[model samples]
Target: MNTLNYLHLDEKRVADVVTALHLLLADFQIHYTNLRGFHWDIKGHGFFVLHSKFEDLYNDTAEKIDEIAERILTLGSVPSNKFSDYLKVARIKEISGVTCGSEAVEHILSTYGHLIGEERKVLDLAAEAGDEVTVSLMSDYLKEQEKMVWMLTAFSSKTCGK
Candidate 1:
């Protein structure tokens, strides 16, 4: 008898994917809050550009958060909803009261770095579970976030040693 989930993935592998998904959900929640803070608090010469960008980021993250929760449900797991739970599972910490545009951007980059790493782990887990839906979703997120990281890195003053 095959011990597979309704989605046809191995039950154990589905459990692992669900665990990673919960972590990813927590990370997105933290990131969403930070983006909102940056949107509201940003000030300086780059304020106009960064303020709008932060709004866009938070909006996008909100959609991703919904998608993540729905995906968790599809995997037969419950998505965590409380902020306290998010704080416990998220690798990214809450960033508050950051007014400087550069500082906020730097924090955004760092948060994205954590998210990218976590997404990679989830991608691998989904692949192992033969979960094509999750694999596709994570792949799309990775592609978009990798571009965001590149663009944000370029916007910063720091440069790779030439």
Candidate 2:
């Protein structure tokens, strides 16, 4: 239909996927800020390891943010760009001034779990809409993030809540 992209997906379903992607974009915006804060603020015994690790994580988060926004554009919608908007819609909240490595890692774990959940939601909608590009994007994200969740949980010295 006229509402569909060149990909010829169901317009209504694609709209649902686009909405989900916008929420995911908001989550990543807050997530990126949190990662940056943890990278800059982390102190104590795990500083050397966690500081570098958080830096890596934030870099990855930045890429994800760009990818998500571009994906939203491809889906014929605008990504949410305002931090105030991000704060309002993001399930992952912005945290700051956290100097403890384990505490920050704990937050990271929680955030990753939430992100995976949201990605799955998007993935499902995309699949329903036959938007394989978005589906693949979410699938790759889910795989890597699930691995990060495992590793972060170990670094936090916690059992897998699963």
Candidate 3:
């Protein structure tokens, strides 16, 4: 009774996926904000590289935020739009004051780790609901993100010595 079932799907079964998507949306917003901070805060060596990288990340994060919010609407639920709501539900934490290039990249990598896991969980949920749209969305995001993780790791090797 709580769902609109516009897609002629079992709204009950997909509700869990909807809930998970809401959490993903919240986490993405926080992640986006953190990247914005990193873009502005990074300094020292590799500043040119990292600053632009952070900007690119935040721009992509903004697109993800829209995708997730729209997915929630597609699932017949409202996406949380407030920062207060985001902080309450997001597993990704807010980070700041990290101006070091290595540290900032490390933070972004760590954040991506958390996001990738969550996206997998969402993928499972969507598959269970027979939601191919959600599945494709997550799959694409995962592919792009995994590549980003690898690239960032490689980029960090020189400075972090990892």
Candidate 4:
């Protein structure tokens, strides 16, 4: 394919941003799965509440995952979605076994905090490298994660009080 290049971007910088974004996507996939699991397994008096919340969160994650992957594509990089790829790239761990609704809420809060930190780092790197698109994408993601962290933390504190 012969195409005239109009935009000049640093290949190395783009690669770095893509790498970081891929990692973020992987982490989101794992978190999305965890949310679904919580939605499925949640019980007790808070079942209705926890189920609804988890579904909403995971649905949003699904949408964000698509957007992140598209941003990676815009940077001329492929978005990885294989299970092995996610397992290798994700920094977050998948929790197993039974836990209460309150525990699920706490888990989500902690995960959201972790995501916020990771996204902040990615956004800073993109900014430093002049990758405005990636920086903007990460900034939006960070805001959403922060909101989730606050909401989940508030729920755990108010309802569980633990």
**lDDT of candidates 1 onward, in order:** 0.90, 0.87, 0.90, 0.81
Number of the top-ranking candidate, with lDDT as the measure:
3
Q: What is the alpha-carbon lDDT for the whole of candidate 4?
A: 0.81
Residue-by-residue lDDT tens digits, candidate 4, 94-134: 87553589888888887888888888888888887787877
User: Least lDDT summed over 10 consecutive residues: which range in candidate 4?
Assistant: 1-10
Residues 1-162 of candidate 1 have per-residue lDDT tens digits of: 332444567777788898999999999999999999999998888899999999999999999999999999888778989999999878898989999988998898888888888989999999998898889999999999999999998888656775
Candidate whose TM-score is highest: 3
Off-target runs (Cα >4 Å) in candidate 2 are 1-4, 158-162
User: Backbone collision count in every prediction?
Assistant: 0, 0, 0, 0
Summarize candidate 2's per-residue lDDT along 38-81 as a digit string, tens digits.
99888889799999999999899899899999988877777877
Residue 119 shift from truth in candidate 1, angstroms:
0.4
Worst 10 residues of 3 by lDDT: 1-10
- Clash pairs, model 2 backbone: none
TM-score of each: 0.92, 0.92, 0.94, 0.89
